[model samples]
Target: MEKARGVRTERIPLGKLEVGQVLTTTLLDEKGQVLLAKGKQITRPFLERLKARGQEYVLLEILEEVEAVAATEDVPLEVKKKTLEDLQDTLTALSQKKSASIQPLEQDVRRFVKGVRDHREVVIPIIQLKKHDDFTFTHSLNVSVIAVFLGKFLGLGEEEIRLLGLGALLHDLGKLHIPQEILQKSQPLTPEEYRIIEKHPVTALKILDEYAAIGGRIKNVAFEHHEKLDGSGYPRRLFGRDISLLAQITAVADIYEALTSDRPYRKALPLFEVVEYLMGNAGYKLDEKVVTTFVSHISPYQVGDVVRLSSGEEAVVARLNPILPFRPFVRLRIKRPDGTVVLSEEIDLSRSLILTIVGEIELQSQIQVE
Candidate 1:
């Protein structure tokens, strides 16, 4: 197993497996495809399932230091750029009426979803290093990934999750038809421009209609992803129970992707604050159940992220705790008056009754953490 700078990897056979072993590196099949990902804390039932599948070995993470290793991109940089370029090409073709095939887009989405699932170590950080030019395509991919996780959490079937993935991926398809100047406008939009923006869902629905290969239910995301439960959303303002569940989930994902992305007008919001916003929007704008399920899948405290505890000492999130989204296992770094350093002190927050995290250790802002 190959080890990165501060991370270590150990391969163990199924018979030697024990619950609670932290996987720092993803396990791969003989063909090198990821079978299981890092940050997945081993559990008895899960381990038993792995053994039942005849899996022989797995590579797990071992910590070596408290160094601030840069967050790795979930999808490799080259892969992401290529995927975005392909998505843009597909969008251009659809807009020009040269083709009605969603095949290219679908293939990319499927590849991306599988990549993120296997590379859980970088799922949340996938968008951290995004180029501003790739925002639209990357946003679609990110939302699709988040929706896939949400669907699985809600016990949806694989095909249903695929539909959700497609819906989230194309939720903003209508935006492609809008004028570029209006879409990328740096200033606040005029009423007319805002009205035009509201029509994207309907516009996307029309485009999806031409492609009979796309599922009818999947097309609803284009029509109603913006609809609010309170009847405040535009272009047909269907309220409460009227919106489809897929559209509702896509709506939450849409809001999240938008808020966390850097826009022409503002910076991305910190993840916990965004989660707080989603929690607040439930019942009024978003489906409460879907919102609850969605947040559980988001890994907020990323590995290598330095954070401040309620106790006033600072620490780095040296490891991730799969069961706890916010509280991960942290390695404490204390500095003495003589400029000496102390490291190797690890604390698993899952078992800690005290030393709660108050907020991120401001230094994390200096580096982009997932």
Candidate 2:
């Protein structure tokens, strides 16, 4: 495995390490001298935070260092720029159309769909970093981006991805009709008030039905995305095949977006936590197939990202191997007593060791809940 500067170097065992000190561990066969194993040991300080919060694992990443390393590498800047522009334009169009009597931004939606279809991972960070305060618009766009990529991963054709994007963008259109007070409330809603919120899918279906151009599939997706596989979800409690594939995909994407985002009720869960939540709830609350696709496509770490290895060693994600989603080659970003950043040699977490992501630090600003 090729290594980069600032990536992690060792994997430590969580059970053998002290709280404050960083560690490195390996995940190779029992012969530790020959090959490294994949796993990490958590320092007590970080572990205490998780314990206090009644949490098990935390996802940790140093955003600035990761970006610094990535900045020095060659990226398809033109493609990234174009995709971000298209995403911004698409979001703007959706917002405008929702507010007025304008026609659906079909072409803009197409561009958004295409952007996601062509380059998903590269564009996701940009989308997640959007600072817009309009929760409805931004949330819709995020859902669309997630859904399109997921659909493509599921072997759906381009046309399906386009439709999925439209469905996602409009999934919560009915929320526009909700009272501003209830929608933007800072506290949990009363049981009666929560019931009203649950009716949005039905409301959205009614709104979409008015437009003859909106077909049955898209309408169903909008109305059923909240429904679950075990008949535990809202809007008629759909189960199994009763829910369409688009609805299933939307459900997974929507929940993911919602969990990763800040809300009045709570702060966002870290990325690794989000993954664990989904993985834990799969089949019981989520569509296992869709969850698999999501887990497979998204990397736990992006290039240049600084992470706290399971071993407690701080490192950067130098390279990503498509075959291993959990482990990537890393370079150690050792910290000196003087607070200076030092670079160390690289290690392949996947091959040399079985390093796990225990936690992550979310760097983006918390969006105002609405």
Candidate 3:
């Protein structure tokens, strides 16, 4: 047996296991190789095979139960709901090749820009309104929200922020022309299909040309959001200085939103992984200034969120660290003998060298354990 922080790892005999038992901790073999991951259900066949292999004991990292806390909203839910509805209508009209007014969408962008300015200090949380069927529209809204926030953080003027917001909102307008089958395919896309996908920027530019009311800057965002600074991105393959600053901002927001949101191809990645990706691509592929500003301002875990610590204990996010958003102050949950969970003293993770947040605890999982 061994213990570190609040976490305990113990060797339990295979005879103690039972069929249909769901494992909350990973089961490791004698050599410390993972035999079964956490959250997996033990079965008779697996236990029989382990016994046949003369495996008498397995290691388990015992985790404590903690009550899940609901997330508090930084952006107004009403604004997101209204914007989604208007975007859906506009996209539907454009897809059908009918005349559509972007006035409603313009108003939506203004409201979002104002919201971002008002809540400048609040850490933005992941939007939970994503639906597989409404991915295009929801993605657009998320991109717009992030872009507007980034623009404000970069100290851009109000008019520029609004235009950036509007452009981000309509950045994926070309997707409306893509066939639903190709867009929603769960399997890997072939080269031909990928080529078709790469044409979205060009398609969007063509679509935007019809709207004389839309300015060149807004059109640039739509057409150049996918272009990278390294000349590796598709379409025109433009390098640094060629891509507009607004497009660069939108590109950062677009990648963040897409990777963080659940997609048809894969599950939503953890915030830490997404941030690492953005950091890795900072100078070579993405704008260094935009990426740096984004990383410093964005918090992976929001206040009131329930997260699992490296110690195997669960904690609630108490406060954010402005300089290091990843490391924040957290209140650990103490499980009492009577099964009641209580909050312990607030621990500043930035000062603690041994403890770190590993992952989030979903409300459903907490309920199941309780």
lDDT on C-alpha atoms for all candidate structures: 0.72, 0.64, 0.82
lDDT of 1 by residue, 17-92 (tens): 6788886667655445666687777689987787788878766555453322234445555555555676778766
Pitting candidate 2 against candidate 3, the one with the higher lDDT is: 3
Which 10 consecutive residues of model 2 have the lowest summed lDDT?
Answer: 62-71
* Comparison by TM-score, 2 against 3, better one: 3
Return the top candidate by TM-score.
3
RMSD of each: 13.3, 11.4, 14.3
The whole-model C-alpha lDDT of candidate 3 against the native structure comes to 0.82
Candidate 1 displacement at residue 71 in angstroms: 12
lDDT tens string, model 2, 77-170?
A: 3433343444445444433454332134455557655655555242233234343356766677677767877887788988887788778877
TM-score, cand. 3? 0.76
Models ranked on lDDT: 3, 1, 2
Displacement of residue 181 (Cα, Å) in model 3 is 1.8
Model 2 misplaced regions, further than 4 Å: 1-104, 120-127, 310-312, 334-342, 352-370
Worst 10 residues of 3 by lDDT: 361-370
**What are the clash counts of all predictions, listed in order?**
2, 46, 0
